[model samples]
Target: MRVDVHAHYFPADYLDLLTAHGSRHTDIARIPCAGDAEGDIDARLRMMDTAGVDLQILSAAPQMPYLEDAGNAVEAARFVNDRYAELVAAHPGRFAALAAAPLPHTDEAVKETVRALDDLGFAGAAVSTTVLGRTLGDPSFEAYWAALDDRSAPVFVHAAGRDLDSPQIADHGLTWIVGAPFEDAVGVLHLLRAGVPTRYPRIKFVVPHLGGGLSFLLQRIDDNYLHYHEAFPALPSTLLRRMWFDTVGAHAPALREAIDSFGADRIVLGSDYPYFQGDLYTRAVRYVSEADLPAEQVRAVLEDNVRAVFDRL
Candidate 1:
């Protein structure tokens, strides 16, 4: 059961909505969204086949159209989740979907999350690191976190519109040079420091792109904590071992380091399919296979861990 846990899909109607209403945080003009409905599914499946992926779990692109009002956010989430459910029902074994919820609007997000799980039969939910320009650790989101923890569903935190106005974005382009990984790292650090895992232990988080440079930056974060314990003492776990990572963009050495830091069971296979970085599944898997990890460990990451996290499907 070769499962690619981290993959994205954009239904046409959703993209149309985004295009109709301009995004506040992200430059939707740059991000290529699926304009046609059937083409998106066809392209995704073709890429999965080319990459030798047996199953691809589809998640909404994290930079969901921003809802100016909280009420609209709720309605938008319902619409997105319904579309995702339709996709999963139409294509049974070939694909599964993670529900999209209206975030920064906790009540609505939680309500939609329950519907996605109970009625739509989605495996889990996908949330961006931040909602309405606020990080996941915001006090308003405690209820949302609690609900996800109660359900024991995994949340896929994708790199979305964070620090869009940062100096890096001005200097370099958006794809993989800096913005994506930087946003992911910042989100992970914020979640850990905000005591998310400590507060909601059962709510598992899967960070994509090899945890977005977290494996290399753990020591730096710990060093800063050592120096400034009084100021920033809320380091949730001991190290990067608590969270799960995906081998989407990690190379051989990086993957080995992630295994050493987080262990094999904490790692899973992910491919940012239908994106320019989509080929990472074939490329990174081949690289990691050459590292001579035991076959069982490979299988656990490539298949079993996904099943464990996405058991609802």
Candidate 2:
């Protein structure tokens, strides 16, 4: 029941293919976690065991989409998903896979999503906040959202790596400081503001890194929405609390704030395993358990919330 919903793995062939292609655009190649040591499934599972995680939901790194060319991205997505399915087949209970799809290529992404879900038995699909710099709410991605809604699949909105042109890359390194969480927040905020959820209510979305700083900024976002309703008629009146988050980078204060704002049912356990911040999961959980949160709420965040989200899959 101790499910780590945000773990990652890439098959050897896929890794080799990425390397052989000399695809240097992705930060994964530059990031330590996406390197060879943590890229293997067995090593990731071993780390999970050490962290007291009983189940790890394996997902492809968001960098996989940097292939950019829709055709190439689709082919690579198929390979990655097929390999992910093979891994799940190899280890029934120990592992489950959240398949990847080639986004921006809505038709191909949808096709791959159905194949992965129906034939591959994948738990769900993983997509970065944006596709080639375009957020999921873009008109180009409506078809992809429609397909996910049709299947009622859970989509993991992971943060993309640092933008190659960003100034932060000059100051702080991509993996160490900003890349991941920044993209995560951007994706979540985009979807919330773009009316994706309102349009397709069945598509369950999970944002990691304690909602990627969203929890900390909820009041500001909500206040802005309230204040700008006249100017921004398209903004949804519902509170941002409708979105779900994971306790990945959250500490005690963050966790308490998220639970207080979003409630426990919407927060699940997430371990960005093998990443530099992997320990955040254990630390956050310990803090919650020790801080005198209701036993039932703590259990829900650690176990039930994940089951509720993934049970359909």
RMSD of 2: 3.0
Residues 1-313, model 1: lDDT tens digits? 7788877766656755655555543344234433234465676666677767777777875756347677767766777778777777777787787878877777887888888887888887788877767887888889888888998988888877555448668455564557777788888787877878777878878899888888787777777787778333364236357678988775777887888777888898886765543565467555556767888887787778777677775
Residue pair clashes in candidate 2? none
> lDDT tens string, model 2, 1-313?
7887887775555766666555664444444444345545565566666666788787886656446677787778888888777767877788788878877788888898889888888888788776666777798888888888898888898876645347766356664366677778767767866778878878778888877677777677767877866332244324345567888864777788888877889998887765633455456446657656889988898878888788743
* Predictions: Cα RMSD each: 2.7, 3.0
- The TM-score, computed over Cα atoms with residue i paired to residue i, of candidate 1 is 0.89
After the best TM-score superposition of candidate 2, give how far the Cα of residue 303 lies from its true spot, in angstroms: 1.0
- Candidate 1: which pairs clash? none
